[model samples]
Target: MNLLFVADPLSSFSVKKDSTLAMMLEAQAKGYAIWHCHIEDIKSVAGAIYAKSQKIKIDMAGSPWYVSTQTKEMKVAAFDAVIMRKDPPFDMSYVTATWFLSQAKLEGAKIFNDPVALRNHSEKLSLLEFLQYAPPTLISYDLKDIQDFHREHQDIIIKPLDGMGGMGIFRVKSDALNLASIVETLGDSGKRALMAQKFLPEISEGDKRVLVIGGKAVPHGLARIPQGGEVRGNLAAGGKGVACPISEKEAKVAEHIGPLLASRGLHLIGLDFIGGYLTEINVTSPTCFVEITQQTGYDVAKQWLTSLEQYLK
Candidate 1:
């Protein structure tokens, strides 16, 4: 099978922990052709989508990690599968990328976490779909509303709707010295919207990332434990990743949400849970494959590829 990965520049990937690289390695091991392209490399020609891409070989022992063997322009639909592996702050450009990928989808390319679903699913707000499993949350651009939420929750987390790797996340207490300032900053004087969720002290334990592949939950979770008094448990924010078996509650959350999303074309996703409450549904480039596999010996990348095989059959 020929797989096209629409992702960031390959130069930016760290093979040690990059999940996309892990997937590429697995696919390569299976003798599948691997092609790489950035979102900007995508184009639409006379209603057909194409990408200026490279045929690449991944060498783990090398310094740069991947070596490009050849370069060419190919119709996106020519590939058997198009993996949308772009990391997100889901900006307008990302939205545009999905639109182009949607064109490829219409032209017979199997796009994982379907382009339409990616556009429709907001990482933070999608949790509202299963609010019964989430903490008390409020999304607003109004300072008064945000202040009201903070006051009601006593301890709350305020974050931008379009952030990943724990960027732009703030934890504020009802009596915090900068609560109002933070609201003003995140909301940008009522011009920008932000999410506020009642703080789950269980964060001290870890922020569990439960991966849902092919409508089923992976048996283990990557518990990213925050370090040095940090409120963010993202590995990018210096949190430590500890692989642990999924809890019954975490499994329940993924079980309830996974198939629903899968039916909508999201074949792979990472559901973030804090204190067993669904915090986010990461459809765009959900990670932790390498971390989970290395720490627990559960090859999530292999499971994902196997799921994709089943999906294709």
Candidate 2:
């Protein structure tokens, strides 16, 4: 089966520590012919979507490094599954890819985390319904509103609603001023909505990345702990990962949202929370499945593939 992964250029296939790389690795190990394409390589011609992709392979013990190229455009229907593995900023290019990948879906290709679902939920913006499970959050651009949230919560986290990998996330204490400048620095007035949430103190214990694949919560999970004096616990942001235990509370949260996410055709996603409060619902290229697998030696790749297979059949 041909599986095409749409991802960032910096991502490609060799970046092993990242979750997307791990999923690709498992697919390769299971002998599924894995192919890759960069966002820039994707194009639409004559109303049919195409990509300048090549049959790429990963060599763990590398030297000359990657061994494929020439970038020829191919029909979108040729693949069995297209994993939308691109990491977020959720910018125009990413949105454009999803718009075009919708064609691949029309051609009967199984695109995980369905294009519509990704379009519906930008990384930090989609799961607002379960606010009860989340810290007090406000999606706004007004500096006054942000200031008021800080006043009420005393401590708060300001995140760009479209960001991922914990980028552009800031924690503000009541003593911290200059929020007006910070909000302005984020964007033009009213041009964007910043995601502001009450800071959860339980972050010292760590934030949990609960992997929901194919609508089932896996036993494997990771606790992303912030280093001393940090509020962000993203691995790319220097957070450490420890295997974590999922409790009834966490599982119940998962169960509540699992069917909703699954119903949207988002087969693989990682929901994050701090102190038992939902911070984000990662539908667009939800990662971290590999981190948990490596920590617990659980192979979830088959679960995802098998689920897609069943649906497609």
How much lDDT does candidate 2 score?
0.77
Please give, for residues 1-313, the per-residue lDDT of candidate 2 as tens digits.
7778887763343365666767776777778777778877878788778877777676657653445644557877777778888777778988898888887788776788789888886666676778888878888878888888888888888878767677788887778676777777774676888888888889998888888877888776788999977788888788999876687788999998988888998888888978888888877766666677677777666677667677667
Among all windows of 10 consecutive residues in model 1, the one with the lowest summed lDDT is 173-182
Candidate 1 residue-pair clash tally: 0
Give the poorly placed runs of model 1, Cα more than 4 Å off.
none
Residue 115 of model 2 has an lDDT of 90
Backbone clash count, each prediction separately: 0, 0
Candidate 2 Cα outliers beyond 4 Å, as residue runs = 10-14, 64-66, 69-72
Pairs in steric clash, model 2: none
For candidate 2, the TM-score is 0.92
